[model samples]
Target: MSETADSLIEVLREQCLIQGQNGIKGLSVVFRAMDIDYSKRIVYEELKIALEKFGLLMSENYLRTLFNALDLNDSGGIDFCEFMHKLRPSLKQCRIDVINEAFEKLDVNKDEAIMIDDLQVIYSTNAKQHPKFISGEWTEEQVLRNFLDSIDTPGNPDGKVTREEFMNYYAGVSVTVDDDSYFDLMMRACYGLPIRGS
Candidate 1:
């Protein structure tokens, strides 16, 4: 069998082992239906069509972005191995870790705090181009104000967000895995799924 076929069979076997017979059966049906060419690999176009057929309408750019993320090997397609791996539940926690890492990078001074100046620079330089901030939905001023409000403490008159405060706010807004709401949003962005209100 070809590598693609072997990959498909292996993924199915693993899913069955992890998700049990019914789980694997359902996934098998979906994969078989999606493998329209019987090549055992899901090309970009096929995945796009399948998503659309499944009523998961997504922008072309978003679709391309999502495809790139899932195509770990840059092989120009997604095999069952890639699909199942990306769909793992632990991805939610992984996303949370990524957010925390980004926060640390933004903290800069190693002071365990994020100052308004730090936020200001990020807002001025990158907020405009950021997917969540673009479209004029959130002005830089609004973001700064919100950040300060969320992190400011009565004793900290200097208006800095402590690392703990920053992490708390970040988790509340973007990282909480409960209900997987934030994770779903991230996944949508990754796959080019439409974000509500944006």
Candidate 2:
């Protein structure tokens, strides 16, 4: 293997040890599955199939963007190292992107802020229906209170959540969750899978 490839494999081995066997085994399975032609690298079409298997169901344009981001050497395909790296920190960012997209959707009035009424409507209408992972283990009231505390400062007591505040709250929560479970949640989010218990 090339030095880069060797380095990438080492990283994957280390991550597997840290994340435990199941996590590493899942990644290995996905990687092998994506290497549909057994070429030891994943091409764009193969990647699309793999993501679909994970329930990502992303648009072609979005997939292209993601593929390009991970194809670091401009190699037209992603090797194991690139794939592992992408699945690591980049997957976390993908989860954040998912959160940001949902937040934008919840900003019903396009006012760049989510009002209490907007939140209430969302919670009432879709919270139970979707049961998003971000809701965590909190009751609706607890989730609402936590969100309010994050955004409603002394100066801004009007019960409105700005995009920044919303993102910050989630980013903070991601770090605070139990390490193993947090990564599991992030992995599920990355794959567009519904998290258990929401």
Candidate 3:
């Protein structure tokens, strides 16, 4: 990465880190704004304009360099997961492992996507008792679908929670938590996974 790109990333990282979870949330909004085509990814042209909107005006060369750096997969565009992970504070290996464990539990079929069927089998009973379901605002299936929609990528709630989507959701939560052990416990409790060293 060039010095300019590195410096830009550092500036954005510091800006986002201070806001914590809201920082991630705000970035999500900005990402959607940049994704004018609703492809859920920002192409070079979109990135260029978005940066200018944020007053980070850069020469074409600088923008290209920074875009390349952010596009880790060289997919020629930046997806929300890649964009978020780049700017958000990284989690420890232990934190990531526990998160993966929770995802595996939810991914009952091991299909890499947590669809409604997997959720029905895994969460149906508990979901029925949810306040919305009990209050008659939503059906049991609606409750499950709502949960999946929350975790799905913005504007692309295809009723499938990909691992990347799951990771991104937790990544937002992880930002507000500073203690690894607390995060681990939260994940275990929320997912109904066995506690470690129990």
Please provide TM-scores, in order, for all candidate models, with all chains considered together.
Answer: 0.33, 0.35, 0.82
- On residues 61-100, what C-alpha lDDT tens digit does candidate 2 reach at each position? 6667667766889899987656654443322655566567
Measured on C-alpha atoms, candidate 1 has an lDDT of 0.56
Off by over 4 Å in 2: 1-27, 90-198
Top TM-score: which candidate number? 3
What lDDT is reached at residue 109 by model 2?
A: 79
List RMSD in Å for every model shown. Answer: 19.4, 17.0, 2.9
Q: What is the per-residue lDDT of model 3 for residues 1-198, given as tens digits with 9 covering 90 to 100?
A: 678777777777666657666555566666788887778789999888776665467778877887898998899999877887777667789988998998898899999989999999888988998999999999989999999988776555788988877887787789888788899999998889999999
Scored by lDDT, model 2 comes in at 0.58
User: For residue 145, what is the lDDT in candidate 1?
Assistant: 56
The collision pairs in model 1 are none
TM-score of 1: 0.33
Q: Rate the local accuracy (lDDT) of all candidates.
A: 0.56, 0.58, 0.81
Residue 111 error, candidate 3, Å: 0.4
- Where does candidate 1 stray beyond 4 Å? 1-28, 91-198
